[model samples]
Target: MNDALEIDDLTLWLGMLEKVVDGSTNMVVVTDRERRIKWVNATYSRVTGWSLPECIGKRPRELLHGPQTSAEELSRLASLIRQGQSVSNFELVNHKKSGEPYHVALNIEPIRDAHGEVCAYLSIQSDITERRQQERHTVELKQRLEVAQRLARLGRIDTEVETGRPRWSSEVFRILGMVPDEAPREFEGLLAFTVPEDVSDLRRSLADGVEAGEELDVEFRVIGRHGQQRWVRCRGVPACEDGRYTLPRSWSVQDITFYKMRLEEKRQRNEELNQLVLARTRKLEESNRALEEFSCALSHDLRSPLRHVAGFAHLIKENLAKGSVDDCLGFCDRIVQAAGRMQNLIEGLLSFSRMGREGLNVERVDLDAMLREVVVGLHDDAGLRNIQWRIAPDLPAIQGDAVLLREVWINLLDNALKYTGHRDISEVEIGWHPHPDGPVFFVRDNGIGFDPEHAQKLFGMFQRLHSEPQFKGDGIGLALVRRIVESHGGRIWATSKLNQGATFYFLLPNIADSAMPSDWGAVESVHAIGCRCGDSQAVEPGLQS
Candidate 1:
């Protein structure tokens, strides 16, 4: 009877132990020494979807392991079990009956016999799939934030108002050329890296902004630890908590060196363009002044010829009424001469007008060859006259419109030949002097030149110092030469004294040195020394090319 009573108590204790293990949330399993499942609780069947009858005599790994399970972990668990060792919280992946993967924290203990030899093993597994997923999401967010900061060259600085302590992101340390350990604790310490010239103003601006609890925006320069200068733009706004200010501010800084450099370059280009426009406006005004002078001269010249024709025609009519043939013939001759002069004036004006409209066909011109060709063409004009041509042997080739430059040489040489008609021998020298902008070429003649005081009028249309009867010309040749020279971004001027020779100088900008002279259009005074072309005494050394 005592044995039966003891057996009943043992049975009750065993049933209570089973209820306690089965009621727990964790899945519980018991395996024999060979790692085959010998028993499983109701919770195991509920969680793993396998009844004890199916799991009996089967390994837990065979029932629960799937592709998500770590092979190395499974091997480690097997080795530990074979050594009769206990392992706690061995996290690993397990699959449900539905083939969905889940994570579990597993605890395993060896059940030893009275001799301390392992005979069975007990394992308890807790589902931890949701916690692991949350950890993975946190790590992904951190990685994305780091990538964004690097790409934008962005950094942050935050200050706690009460402590006045600063916190800097890793990127901020990199931007300041400082190591993570060297991060500044005080907000004022950041000013140590600022450039000296900007530090004072930057500090004041930032302090004022913080004091007012307002947004801050400023650009300044900083000197890095490596001594490199960099431009940075910093922006921030005050932070508030519980509707009251807590964090004074946080700043977002970005490197803007390249952007500032581009703005500076654009500003310089705009200034240069403005200067160019001003120069062009000045040139236009000068051209307008010249045209005004031409207009006044044109009116006087045309009206004089018309008046002469009218007066002489009226005389011829009166003489014809009297039947006086001799007097009428004289009047008719005068009218014809006046009409011819008017026609020449109109043609010259038309030719000058066309010069401004023509576009330049620029090319390399061999000036020496061109000068020789010009002399050959003018040979007939110098017939029976003693003329000496001294051209410089080293006249350099230049870039210009060949046809227009040829005209320049023609007009200059023709004037030289015409003015020196009274001289027994005409001496003309063609040479160039070196100039910074280009070569200054001159045509010096031993002909009768105008007074030095009237030199400015030499290039004005129809403004002649000498009478038309003495040196026959329309007085438009020099003016035409000036137009062509200026069109090529060059300058021209003349110098002379009464009864002495004249020198006409022009400068054509070299292609290699195409920049025009700053003092362009300024007249230069060149003194003259004379010698006859055919005289035994050689031409004046100074006058020779």
Candidate 2:
């Protein structure tokens, strides 16, 4: 029974020893006193591509050492082994059976006999090729990041809140114009470099961010250690663990002086442009006012002389009709016609000039009612030409100056009647329709229409489409219509086909309100006084007496 128990214990001890050697991931080799390989574990054979049978009779130098192995490391390892001591943590290059070089971390220990003499050596090795390559890659990445941060003028900072301590990267020190050794170690020390006016605000913002467990973003000015001032934008976020903020906050700061300078330049340029526009607008308004006054005075003064010439010529014709004076009568007739044509031209010019200068009193006016009144007045006039007129039903009301809009309708209808002269059953149509944005009023006529190519010129002062003999006109009617419509924030245009017909369209805004009454009575009184002198056949009685 005692023998069996001893055998069982021995088996267990052997199994544990086997496991200790075989289970190790590191390559292991055992050698005798002459440095001849005695045993090699599985890992050693796997790593070096040499079986135990191939390596058992060879020395350690023969199995692993080559020209690549450093002579200094070998000498140090030999010295330690000779003194019956163990050597550890030595790095060296070794060769495989395939002639490939490999780096390893080697630990060799000398085995001692009972007499205190070294009898064998045990070696443990770990392949470090991949680990060394990873280290190189990490170094390269750090170098690239540093270069990028320098070009971007950016800096990084890390601060521990519990200790109020701070650490800056190399770029941060460079940005602050301080050496790494000279950098501030405490938060207060870093805050001292900030501009006096911005320091308190930055502190408040940082405190709020930390309290709320939020990210921080702020812009402030700082004075570098060299006394140089710069604008910087800072952004940072906290890292937390286990419901408490454990990691120091990390932040990036960037210089923004160039961007701020560009914004200021743009603002200055805009201010200059606005000033130039204001000056030009003022000058243009002054010139327009002066031109309006000159046109009014010219029209007012020319009326008196024109009336005198027409009256005197008529008297001469009446007196000469009693005698055989054919030549004198013909001369008087030419004089009367020329004076009448000049007076018409002057009136047309005055109306065109006054259209743009007049103030607008905009209100809702029923276009249907206004057109009805205009058509009735035209039909009642003496010596009116025969024409067919049609007005559409349910014309919508528009907001506009009533007096100015009335003139627009009158001028359009009169032109239609005059241009269709002597035609059998001359037709005129006045109507309104709903447009996309507002109401459009139109006057259509079956007249001697002009070409569409010349439509743009139709609304110019004195822009007669036909000769004086073909169609007599001062050519100011459409021009006055265009000005009046535009002054009420509207638009005017015309469409026509030669010899077929012409249609004039104008748009006005629709508003729901009552029409504002104008001082039409005063205007009529003024017109009556002017017309009385215009129709008189004799000179003023006071001048004659």
Candidate 1 residue lDDT tens string, 293-384: 56966788888789999999888888889988788888888889989988988887876776756789999888879998998788676789
Residue 483 shift from truth in candidate 2, angstroms:
26
- Each candidate's lDDT (Cα)? 0.77, 0.72
Alpha-carbon shift of residue 441 in model 1 (angstroms):
2.5
| Worst-scoring 10-residue span by lDDT in model 2 | 535-544
Q: Give lDDT tens digits, candidate 2, residues 1-545.
A: 22322433433533454578876889887777788877778888888999988998798778778878899988987787777776677888888888787889988877655555566677888989788779888899988888888888777776655765577767767767888873446434555678999988898887777667788778888799889887777787756777765223677877776777788899999899899889778757854754764564466435654766777676676767777576666667767776787778778767776664567887767777988899888777715577787666556677788899999999998889878885887788765544445655667788888897998889865567888678877667887888788778778877777787777777776544342124445434533433332323112222222
Candidate whose lDDT is highest: 1
Off by over 4 Å in 1: 1-58, 111-122, 155-253, 257-347, 372-379, 382-394, 417-429, 445-454, 461-471, 498-501, 511-545
Per-residue lDDT value at 2 in model 1: 27
lDDT of 1 at 468: 79
TM-score, cand. 2 = 0.46
